[model samples]
Target: MFDRLRLMSDYEAPTPVWAPASVGAFVLSPTHLDHLGLDETLRTRLLRWQQYFDDHHPADLCGWDSPGSSQRYASEGEQLREELERALPGLRVELDLWPVPADD
Candidate 1:
């Protein structure tokens, strides 16, 4: 996704993860990506995942934190995460509340 950007081996992608949605999880990476190219690169990856998530799942499946929402395609989400891990190892799926970019 970020093929144009100058990627680095040390660059850690900011994965979105759930955290009760009330207290919230550290959706974005805590580490500062000082490199402009790297930040954009990470965002590109995130946005791609966001699009995939939106397209595959229903809008109301906010997270496990939602009321009576635990059973809404629960395994599907996990499958997505697993697929992501297998596809992009080392970068755990942490994306939860991070908003995906609009198709511009």
Candidate 2:
């Protein structure tokens, strides 16, 4: 799912947005379905995550035009952290950015 999001970010050509039809499809298989029941809480969290990706991230990424982009990223990162805490308890999400040397 993260890879798909990155690919969408890298894409230059205009294209239709893609979102997963079902979180279950991305996070579980038929064999695992029994173990992980489809519940309201999980559904709500997945919908929120999907909506954030579809709306918030794209708007920020497209409108980014300043030195404070990192701040915006950090803000979004914090939101994701909070959401993950409530949704997946004990799960950790980290964001890392590496600067390329000026010589590059």
Candidate 3:
């Protein structure tokens, strides 16, 4: 089982994992939102973020072009981190800094 969960934005599929084959680490992207034991409110927020990303940055690497949208996404990511920690105390939650330029 994974001991840590990372939250980050991505292109079609966000790879939240920090390192390849890293011990006790895994990504908790929106794709797995349905299978996880997330509260309704938290789940809804995640779903919204996913939809927002899909709509705004469908073909882009990141949603940095729109400052407002990216900021909102980052804010929501922070909230998700907190909610995930509360819901799954067993796992360590990490939220990646958002608005990271595609070039970076």
Best by lDDT: 3
Ranking according to lDDT, highest score first: 3, 1, 2
lDDT of each: 0.36, 0.35, 0.61
lDDT by residue (1-104, candidate 2, tens digit) is: 32221111211212112223433213333233223342455434434434444443355465434435434444544564455445444433332222211222
Deviation from native of the Cα of residue 84 in model 2, angstroms: 1.2
Which candidate do you rate higher for TM-score, 1 or 2? Answer: 2
Q: Positional deviation of 92 in candidate 2, in angstroms?
A: 2.6
Q: How far is candidate 2 from the true structure (C-alpha RMSD, Å)?
A: 9.6
Each prediction's TM-score versus the true structure? 0.27, 0.31, 0.66
Residue-wise C-alpha lDDT for candidate 1, range 1-104, written one tens digit per residue:
11111111111234333222344332334242233223455445544444444444335654233323333323334555555455444444432322222221
- List candidate 1 stretches off by more than 4 Å: 1-26, 29-37, 60-104
TM-score, predicted candidate 3 vs. hidden true structure = 0.66
Which of candidates 2 and 3 reaches a greater TM-score? 3
lDDT of 3 at 62: 42
What's the best-to-worst order under TM-score?
A: 3, 2, 1
Q: Model 3, range 1-97, lDDT digits (tens) per residue?
A: 4567666655555433232137534445545655566767877776666667666665654445576766667667777778877887787877775
What RMSD does each model have against the real structure? Answer: 12.6, 9.6, 4.3
Off by over 4 Å in 2: 1-64, 97-104
